[model samples]
Target: MELGYIVSGLFVGFVVGLTGVGGGSLMTPILIFGFGLSPLRAVGTDLLFAALTKIGGVWSHWHHHTIQWHIVGFLALGSIPSTLITLQILKTFQYHDQQLTYVINLILGIALILTALALSLKGWLINTIKANNSSKVVLIIRHLRSNQDFIMISTIVTGWVLGFIVTMSSIGAGALGSVALLYLYPNLYMNQLAATDIAHAVPLTIIAGLGHWHLGSVDTHILFNLLLGSLPGVFLGSRLSISIPDRAIQITLSTLLMLIGIKFIL
Candidate 1:
């Protein structure tokens, strides 16, 4: 049992539970920079870690009747297959290939920066959308409401983009997904939006994580350690989420991610 890894998991899981950001945004970088794991190993281990950690959230959200299954199905339609395809492509590349690792790190860095920006801008974006009910964006939303086909097609396309990014970096299924859903389902209750995102992420992460496992990138030992600490941490954090002032947390997290992102890019 690696004590440091367990502690790291506890911190990351607690943050995820409180903020609803994907664990990968924190855990993957922690593994790489904090623990000195290779980029591929960090991403692979974080994928499975995220998958298992989110299962409990699914049940809790389901019990509260918060999930939007139709949306989740639409997301899965594109995400699942894209994850598999991305995994297969990674398998063909030698794991130790410097170029492959560099590419993964590059993608991971960009994803982190985007996730931070998304987090920082989320409240403003949502408020802007809500405030401008008569704006052109509102016109687009109204059109989407009337056009189910276009909405479905757009949802699938978003899933495809998320799947590809998550497969490579174990990020995006939460922060980026939430931003997308906020635009796609403008009227969705914020709590329901969060629950739906969590529900969709479970299967996507599990499938993508298992694919990484098959390719020998996953570290079972590290995964176990993370789970051991994270399960309890998540429960505790979630219980406290309602009382915590989240804007401060989001800003702090976003700043940290930006620094990490810049470091990775360099």
Candidate 2:
């Protein structure tokens, strides 16, 4: 077991726990640039790493009664099928082709930028919605609150977009999904919203990881090393979240992600 890989996992898991963002937004890039792994292997290994780490979150959140099963179901309705289709398309691309690597890196870079922006601007966006009672999306959500069918359809559509982005880059299921859900169900407790998003991410990532494994993209050794460190790291970070002010950490993370995004794109 590489101690360095374990350390990488530990740091990423801790950050994810502290911020409630997906590890893929950090982990995949670390593997590629920090650990000198290929982009494909980094993405594949991080997917499984993310799924395993979140299982612990789900279990804890379940005990706390934070997960909203109906919302999770609605998101899964769109995500699972979209994930399958994305994997099939990914498989059609030639393995290890220079063009393929470029495309993956480009997508990964773009996804990272998007996630960073989402994280950095989320509070502002939410506040804007609260301030502008006439905002179109906010008004639509309010109107649809009583219309279960419309709400369900909207949630599924959100999930579909999440599924496609996540399978392609493993970046959106946390930051993007939570923000979208916050818009849809603004009345839910923040803890419940985070828990529901984490719960839904588990299956989405696991299936996506399995699809990558099927295509022989996964590195079991890397996955195992990361899991070894992440499990305990997540536990420790969750404990610390109660005391730490996350805004500072989030700002630091956003800066790092922006730099990384630019690096990958360049």
Question: Which numbered prediction scores highest in TM-score against the true structure?
Answer: 1
Overlapping backbone residue pairs in candidate 2 total 0
Minimum summed lDDT over a 10-residue window in model 1 is located at: 137-146
Q: lDDT values of the candidates?
A: 0.89, 0.86
lDDT comparing candidate 2 with the true structure: 0.86
Quote each prediction's TM-score. Answer: 0.94, 0.91
Model 2 pairs whose backbones collide: none
Q: lDDT tens digits, residues 70-109, model 2? A: 9999999999999999999889984756877898789888
Per-residue accuracy of model 1 over 1-266 as CA lDDT, tens digit each = 39999999899988877887848999999898898888878888999999888898899899999999999999999998899899988988845579988999899999999999999999988887677568887676676767878889989998999999999999999999999999888889998998999999999999989988888889999999998888877877888889979888888999999988888889
Stretches > 4 Å off in candidate 2: 132-149
Determine which window of 10 residues in candidate 2 has minimal summed lDDT. 124-133
Candidate 1: give the clashing pairs: none
